[model samples]
Structure formats: C-alpha cells, structure tokens
Target: MTSVGTPPAAPVTAEAPMRRLDRRMIWVDAIQMVISLIPTVVALAVFKVEPRPQVIWPAALVAVLGVVTAVNDLFRWLKTRYRVTPDRVEVRTGLLVRSNLSVPRDRIRSVESTANLKQRLAGLRVVTIGTGRHASAGEATIELNAVRRETAEELRRLLLRGADRPDDATVLAELRWRWLLYNLVNIWAFLTAMFVIWSAYWLLNNFGVELDTWVLGLADWEALGPGVTIAVATAAVGLIGVAGLVIGFVTEFWEFRLTRVRTAAGTALRTTNGLLRTREVNRDDNRLRGVHIGEPLFWRWMGAADTAVISTGLAKAGMGAEPASTILPRGPIAEALRVARLVLGGDDRPFEAPLRPHPRRALRRRVIWALNTTGALTVLLLWLDLTVEALPGGLWLAGPGVAPVAVLAAVVAYRALGHTVHGRYLVTRSGLLTRSTDALDRSAVIGWKFRQSLLQRRLNLVTVIATTAAGYGRYKAPDLDLHDGVEFADRATPDMLTPFITRIPPRR
Candidate 1:
C-alpha cells in the first residue's frame, strides 16, 4: 500500500503461514447440501410426475458433479496452509490449478474475517486481504475453515504487523445481533408497507371500472379532484416502505456474523471479531480519513447511529466497493465515536468554533430544486386529473394540492442545506431530516479545493473540499464556511496549532 503522505517503498514482505486456514471447510459445503436438494425426493405426491428413464442418467451425472466438487474442496481445505515471515505472507493452495500467493507485510491494507452460521458452529473462518486494488479478489487472500478462535487472532496479529497494540485494539463482536435487529426494523417496515400495497391492489381490482385503454393513455390532470390523488400517493409510499423491509430482512440474512480480529498494525479497529471471509486493508494510508454519521430519525430516537467511512477502493466478490464505510457502522455516538477514535489514533481534536452555511444559499438551492419538482408534479397531476374525472373519487380529492406540495418540498430541501464545522473538526450536513456530516482532523488535510460553476462563482459561492487518504471521507464546506465567519482557508491555520503538521501534497 503506497501512502501519498508517506513515501512509497518496495513491497514489504509478510511471513506466509504454512496453513493459517484449516482444511475442514468441507463442513461448510456439507451445510450447503440442505439447500441444493441433491437427495432429489422430488415432491412425488404433489407433482405426480415420475422421472423419465431417458433423463435419469443425466440428472444423476449432474448430481455426481456437485459431489465431486465438494470432495475436491474438502481435500484442498485439508492441505492449504499459510505462514508469515517478517517480510512476506505466503499461501499455498490448489489440488489442480497449483498456485502460490505471496503478499508483502506492508502491502496489506487491513485484515478481516467471518464465519457463516455453519462455519461458526464448526469454528471455521474466511479471510480477505484487501490489496487496495480490484485485482486481488481471488483465493480470499487466506481462508481457514474450522480453526480455533485463538488461532485466528494469532495469525491475524502476525499478518498485520508483528506487535499487537493494546491501545489500538478494535474488535467488534456484536454485529450479528445488531445487524439482525436492524434487519428486523426493515422487516417491520415491509409488513407496514404491505397493508398499503394490498389496499392499492384492492382499489385497482374493485374500482378501476369502465377503463378504456385509449382514455387511460390520454388522461390529463385537469379532470380529477385532489383528494383521490393524495390517497393513491399515500398508498404507494406505504407499499414501497413495506417492500424495502422485506428486502432488508432477506439481504441481511446472507452470511451474517460478528467478526473477531487482532493484528500487528497502525490502528487497532481493523481487527473484527467475526466475518465470513478473511480481509486485509490499509489503515495507516487512511488514518486521517473521516466518516459521516447518519442515523435516521427513527434510529436516532432509538439511540442508535449508522456510521460509514468513505474510501475509493473498488468492490470485491463479497467485499463491498465501500466495505470500510458500511462495515464501520458503530452504535450510539458514544460507543461509535470511541471506536472511531481508537481506530483513528491521530484524530482527537474537539469542536471549538462552528462554521455554519449561509441561509440564503440554502434557500436559493431549495427554490431551484422546487421549480424542477413542480414541473414534474404538473405533468403527473395533469395526467391523474383527467383519469379521475370519470370515476367517483375516494378521498382527499384539487389542482392547488400538487403545486403547493411540490413547492413545499423544494423549500424544505433548501432549508435542510445547513452545516456546522466546529474547531478543527468539520460536520457539514445537508439533507431533509437525514443530513450527514464528514468528521475529520483539519491539520492532517493534504489540500483543499473550492469548486463552482460560473453561476455559483458569480454568486460568490463555492464548495470547500478537504481530503486525506487516512480520512474515510472528504469534508465539504458547501455554500459557505469559515470565510463568511471570519475563518481563514490556508495550510497556515493548521501549522499554527500543531507544529508536527506538515504540508500534504495534493491528492492523486
């Protein structure tokens, strides 16, 4: 991993373990059998269709292929080993495709691991080594199926560095429970949405009468009362919400677990207690990077928060393009912030002064957005109105309704574009109710850029963006910042506070 802040160097070596991962992973495949239906009982009574002799042999051949693959995986798992030297980590794998994977110690970005439900029961694990690139997805870097809990940590420690820093230890063991509940909230939302959907289906089935396809196509808004439109909209939103929850529940269920990890490294938080696969990442490169905390109104009320670190890494097979950002989600600010601080050792400055965005700027942004929304509404409303004129309206049935609502949305978005940067830390957020802020160290910034279009430049308004790789995200002083509030935008501002602060080159 090359650090722009730190000088680049030859790829550091890591002592490759002879076999960091156990070969008993066949156990994981055993679990999959339940899902594959290899037994092929074939609901004979229900289908009343017996297998034809002509196709039986082919089906049997396919089943044999699956069993053969599973067997091959078992043998490979049993033979694979990983060993790490002071300079490089080596992985030996494959029964047929013979290959040796060697990654340097310093080249490792971060280490992550996971265990599926069956793997968890068997004490098996998967590891991912993030090369900080898109090409290193194969082999998962290292995978140990059914290894002991302590062994995984020991290997993790050696792979990251050589020393396990107590002060930097960051192990998350409760993601499964937390993620499960989070998915539960989504499921409830889905169920709630179903009521609205089923209601819509009812309306369409029972009330969509005397429909002429041509009339439906030509329908314009000048014909209907506003009450019916509102009801339909409300129903539509409710149904969508329910659909979201169902998807959340199903998606969250995939290979979920709290991970365990301990690595010899810069920041400690990279070590997670449990994950289905092994992963390595670069913490030092992104040490100064920051994250934005966005807790929805509902989650906030429940005293929970979702934290995400922004980075530029591409996604892997299971590695999210922004895995670091999404996986770093911490809880209640107190706990989350503590974890963040531990992981980001250099970032501890508190909020001293607040930099707020200009109200007029936000308002202008809102007005422009409102006009566009109004235009969309005009079209929708016009079409609905024409359709409604032929049917007896249900409820909340007007022309003013659409314009007022569209304009209101624009106003709200404009009003929502506000930010507050405190002391050396900046929290710039702009969203309706779900605003987000990029929190990071000011002194560590590599450089700052202000960008705006001609219209914005003429308005004397531009976005102030500061960046750092250690930082998870880039902070933006949009619309307004310290300039309006008597603050200076220069590298000197940081050096004045921290003498150790040096000039960081422009981001690549």
Candidate 2:
C-alpha cells in the first residue's frame, strides 16, 4: 500500500472523474423483490378463481412491488455518485434530499468491503468507510452498497494510504481449522439453541401439533427414567448448540488471513475472511491505542484467547458483534499477545507490569456485600414460606448456600484487580469468570474521574476511571488505595492528575 500525503483540495476535474455504483444493482434489487413476492404468488395460486378480483389482487401486488423496487433502485444508481481525489473521497447521493459526504484521507480509519455469494459472482461488493464517529447510518458515514470489487479496492487503497512507516508489511497470523473448536465454548450459542427449542415447541403446539407426542415425545421418560431422560435431553441440546457455533465459525472465518502492512503514513492492519460474505477490513495503525485480550475460563484452559485492538473507530471492547476489531480469533494466548504487540507498532514492552493492588478492605467490602445480598434473599424466602405455607423442601437452603458461592467468586475478583503504567500504556486487568486485560494508550487519556462509595471513602480507597473518546470510553481501576491511585494517575499522564492532589504536612 502507498503512503499518502495531505493533498490540496483538488476539485472534481476531467482527470479525476466521478463514478457511479454498478449498473447490476438494479437486478439485485429486482431479485430481492421477487423473493419478497413469494407469499403473494402462493396467495394468488391458492385463491385462484375465474373473474375473481381478490385472486388478481395478489398478482397486482407482486407486479407493483417488483416494478417499484426496480425503478427505485435504478433511480438510486443514477443519483449516487462518488469521486476520489488526492486528499479525500467525496460522495453525492439522494434524488430529493441531495446529501454530500466527504471523508478526508487522513481521518479515514477503516475501509471495509463485504460481498455475498451472489455479489462475489458478479464482482460487486458493499464498502463501508469508517471515520472515528460512532453514530447511526447518517453520521457513521460512507456506505457504498453495490460497487465494483476493483473500484472498491481502489477506493480502499486511496483512502487508507498513509505516510510510510520504517518497517515493511508482515503476515501476523493465519486462520487454523482447529482453533474454531474454541468458538464452541461461547455460552451464547447454548442459550440460543435452548431458546429456539422451546420456541419451536410452543409454536408447533399452538398450531395444533401435539409436541408431547411428536418432538418432545421422542424422549421415552417412562422407559429411560428421569435421570436418563434429563441426560439425553441435555446432550441433544448441547449438540444443537455446538452445531450452531460450528456453522457460524465455519462461515465467518473460512479462509481468514491477517496481515500488517507498512504504508507511508504508518502501519496498516488488514484482515480478510468469511465464506458466505467475504469481508476485508483495513485499519490505520495510529488509531490503535491499546489492545484488549480476553481469556474465557474454558478457552483459557484450552490455551486459546481472543484479542481485539482498542482503536477509536471500532466498536467497544468485548462487543463481539464487530468482527473487524478482532485481531485474533480463537488462537493460542501467546499468538494473540504477539499479534497484539505487532499491531501496537512492535512495542513488546509488557503492559502487564507489576501492579499496585487495592487494599485488603476492598476484599472485605466484597465479602460483606455478598453475605448481605444472600441474607436478604434468605429472609425473603422465609417470608414467602410464612405467608403462603407451600414451598419446596430444600428451596430455602439454596438461599443460604448462595452466600458462600458469591463470596468465593468475590474473592477471586478481588485477587484479579490490578493496574499498572507500562511505557506509554495504562494497563489494567480484572474480572473473575472472563478475565480481561486492557492496555490503553496514556496519550489517548482525555479525562480522569475519581469515584468513591460510602464504604470506599472510609477505607481511603477510590475508583479512578480514565476516559477516552474511543472504544468503551471509560476504563476503571477500581478500589485502589487513595494515595497510590492518584500518584499512579499523575505518573500515567504528567500534570493531568497532579493539580487535584494536595500534600498535607505531618502533625506534631
């Protein structure tokens, strides 16, 4: 990729010609219209009768939908025009509203292109140009739904071209089929499968199908017994859940490839993946301030972790919906960390430097909170028993048992809390179930906030949150020793937090 320089605002001249979307967009729209009109076709055939206006209504609706869609798409193609100049990309669209959007070359954070099977065959792709603005479609900016693949690449190259960095491009990581097994550990998939199973049972039953004798009936509870029946049902649900995750990973990361490219401006990170909808995302290296590496309990044991760049334009850390932000999929933890280092301009300085831990009182506070919460639940259960007089025999015991579990989890969390300043990064690690280590850029720290609870104030512990305009805005180093927290903040960004601190002389 070529390094870009700030070019003079060159007007759209004969040499720099404006371009339109692929003319084939009309056919794509027409095909979509026909698919949508399937119900109408079915309705027409089912209610067919000679001289019946009602039967003809479905046909008329289909025709109207198809014609309207085709005409609208054609008009849209004609109205939408984009131009690539030396400094920026300019797009003018809307037949009536007439809105023009411009993205400066310097500010272009990422240019992502995706193409479905049909689009791939036609050499057309949807390109989304991301600036750091996180808003709705109107503000999140440029989106070209149906552009020629070659033209989209040219736009990507032009928009993301930056100043040449010293290092050459390198391949960071490649996709591995075995790593996909780690994707199955995601709990969301199991929950979804269970929900779907229950929903399907309800829907089918409501439509007069006897689920008890059809689907659910397959489990012969009488012959298998309760234990066996439950085990079989659990296995089936687990299989379904695993299947969903397998299908999802297969389609999303089929031929995944990640590369670090050197450009005139800086290092550029690019990823190309997906089987159903092939996608490519190019991100400027400078926008990347930090990295969030996640290690879920199961995946961690499997020696796998996922890493996402804590960049400005991308979605917040831990929001797994945005695949573009993920630098490494389910891979070895070491590999994820290595890739993370590469993205941070080969800064291998350990962000997980020895951290100043919170006081023991912080752990005490957690224990107290957990016990109180469970105690309240126990009281509630007792009150219910007194009022209603009908309750499960061991249900009340569960309320008290929860206290120990909560305290154990809290103990683990207390141990996990740690923060440190490493080089130019403000690193923090926390969480019990799913541990997260974030190494945010000190330079990216826009503001600081000090928070204290009633108990925290008495214990001289405070939660200091470093605020930034990028990725999850606020990251907290919670329950820190008051003096140490302030000192750490001041050191992280000199003079920023010092004004708030005042020294008190020793009393005689």
Model 1 lDDT tens row, 327-350:
443356555555445444444433
- What overall lDDT goes with each candidate model? 0.51, 0.75
Off by over 4 Å in 1: 1-21, 27-83, 91-101, 134-151, 163-184, 187-267, 270-288, 297-304, 309-322, 325-355, 376-412, 415-423, 470-473, 481-488, 491-508
Q: Which candidate tops TM-score? A: 2
Q: After superposition, how far is residue 482 of candidate 1 from its true place, in Å?
A: 10
- By TM-score, how accurate is candidate 1? 0.60
The local lDDT score (0 to 100) that residue 405 gets in candidate 2 is 92
Residue 56 C-alpha lDDT in model 2: 55
Predicted structure 1: lDDT? 0.51
Q: In angstroms, give how far residue 2 of model 1 lies from its true place.
A: 4.8
Candidate 2 per-residue lDDT over residues 184-302, each given as its tens digit: 87777778678777766644443345566785566557977889887887888888888878888888888888888886566778888889787777777777878888777656678
Candidate 1 displacement at residue 405 in angstroms = 4.8
- The C-alpha RMSD of each candidate to the native structure, in angstroms, is 10.6, 5.5
Residue 263 C-alpha lDDT in model 1? 37
TM-score of each: 0.60, 0.81
